[model samples]
Target: MSGLRDLTKTKGDRLAYTATSSSTVNRRKRSFILSGLVALFILVAWLSGYMIDPSHLSTHLELRNLPPSLVHPFGTDWLGRDMFSRTSKGLGLSIQVGLLASACSCFIAAALGLAAALGRTADAVVSWLIDLFLSVPHLVSLILISFVFGGGMKGIIIGIAFTHWPSLARIIRAEVMQLRSAEYVLISRKLGKSRWWVASRHIFPHLLPQLLVGLLLLFPHAILHEAAVTFIGLGLSPHQPAIGIILSESMRYLSTGMWWLAFFPGICLLLVVRSFDTVGEHLRILLDPRRSQE
Candidate 1:
């Protein structure tokens, strides 16, 4: 939004910070480590699910409320379901929702953002609509939309995409507007390149790194939000295993000694959220040229 912005113009420390953020630089090592950890969890959860039928059901009322021990690593719930298996499976479900929802949101963001950047009447309408959506809390918007759409995977995807795209669209619009006049972009147009050609080749490519960083940040939010909705009984069906559902069911037994029922699943959720945030922060730094320079 600032007039004729230049990446090089910065306070000393700011420039240093930017330099440190260059995505293509030294931090690849740390980024890889963080990413690998997430991948490992996903792989383990996925493979474990196929090998074991979590629906077999456990029946041990006496051992049901036991603490974490060798036989039941994460302990047992009220129904005697293995917290380890349920928690692991729940993670898979959570990540699935997060991945699908975030992908949909990012796609919507890109499309709407490009539309807004075109500077047309349609762009104005989209701007106003996006603003209206943004005015409400994202969680509330998602909840309302999900309820309207009939609470399930379809609803979750639609709700998340609809609620979250506004911010990304606005950010991308600003970026596109800035890039539209950049040296590379202008040069492409001056050479008689098609509008689409210039935007696609010069403008969009420039936005990719930052967009990726933003997406990584968005993933955790989507996952956690989905879990929250489920916890409140508005998300996934109770028949299916999910982190929220597991915890929500566990609430009835909290006073009992079976603390591990909620404990382990909660830990799994925490790790996944933290992992996403860690990667997102690192990506934000790496993608910003100024940070890289810093």
Candidate 2:
């Protein structure tokens, strides 16, 4: 009877393990599917603007400031431009700028971080530089940089790229420092492997995950900062139908109760930013081995 009881308990444990494994797999599958949908939504939105002819977004004074209707889905702005088209274009522009700035920032962060982990001197110098940048308020620094660069697309991109790297650099530096002390790293060094060789083979593979997460995480901040700077008239020109420009122009008529001018674009911007953030978070969870197991 005892043997039979022991066997029964073992079978129950196996069944529980199988059930847990199946549950985890299902959760992971759902997570990936959700992430894909978010990605598709962002892609479609960007394409909607990018693929459309610029002439379609032109002003038509006759239809100006019309409230939301079937003819003008998101309503016409004060200039009679289609709010839908304008919002879509603005969003696409934001995504473009965000992508460029985020990539540049991530590149800067990765380079500085790897350098900092190279030696004590390099580490101290890079750390000091990071701190110096971080000391200044980000928005102020961004505006100053943009102003110096003449306040346009180039200015916004450069400003965001330069200002956003310090935090991510510090994180990467710490990660590299930890990886530098690992047994395999020491072994490779002792085996007379060139630093570059070990770095490319061992260190880089380990760092790729962190680098990607940092890049995606930076996207929303880049977009928001670009919009803010533009709104303040230090980022992009008013001629551009950027979300910032749209919102800034909308302010003039807000007293007249034209709320839709700001409402639709604001919501679109929020959704785009949130979508990027969600993608980054989901990627982080999916890539985390410990969480994946659970």
Candidate 3:
């Protein structure tokens, strides 16, 4: 009887484990689908903006200040520019800038993070730098850095790259610190493998998922900051159909009641930003071992 009871318990446990595994697989599938859809939307938006001709964005006096209509989906700006084209172009530019800035930032974070694993002195210095950067407000530092770099696309990208890495770096540092004490790493060292070899082979592979997620997470902040700086005349040129410039120019005409000028572009920016954020979050869940199973 006791043997039969043990057999029943084992079967129940197996069934429970199978059910949990199925649930985890289903959750991962849903996350992948959602991430893919969001990424597709972003790619389409970027391509639409990139493929549009500058002439299409040219001012048309006849269409100036027109309200949203079937012909002009986002309506027309005071200069008679199609708000749709302008917003698309601006978002594309923002995405481009964000991509470049985020990549650079990730590189910085990864380097510093790995360096922090080298020694106590290196860790201390990296920690201090991280703290120092974190102490200042992001916007203020971004503005100052943009001002120092003379506030163009280059300046904006550089400013964002420099400013955004501290937090991610700290995360990477902690991860690397833990990884250093991992049993496999210790065994590698004991086997006379060079630190560089162990790091590149073992540590870096472990860090890749974290880095990818961090890069995606950084995109929204980079795009928003770029827009903010450009809005205040410290980012992309005003002549460019940047979202910031579009919104900034729209402010004067808002009193004149041309609402679509700011409204559509603002909504588009928010959607794009939110899409990036969603993708990052989804990727985080997919990549995080603890969350991936849940």
What TM-score do all the candidates reach, one by one?
0.84, 0.96, 0.94
lDDT of 1 by residue, 137-158 (tens): 9999899999999998788878
* 163 Cα displacement, candidate 1 (Å): 0.8
List candidate 3 segments past 4 Å from native: 1-15
Clashing pairs for model 3 are: none
TM-score of 3: 0.94
Which residue pairs show collisions in model 2? none
Which ten-residue region of model 3 has the weakest summed lDDT? Answer: 76-85
RMSD of each: 7.8, 1.3, 1.8
**Best candidate, TM-score:** 2
Superposed by TM-score, candidate 3 places the C-alpha of residue 145 at a distance from the truth, in angstroms, of 1.2
Alpha-carbon lDDT of model 2: 0.90
Best by lDDT: 3
lDDT ranking of the models: 3, 2, 1
In Å, residue 80's CA in model 2 sits off its true spot by 1.1
Clashes of 1: 18
Worst 10 residues of 2 by lDDT: 195-204
Q: How much is the lDDT of residue 182 in candidate 1?
A: 81
Residue 102 displacement in candidate 2 (angstroms): 0.2
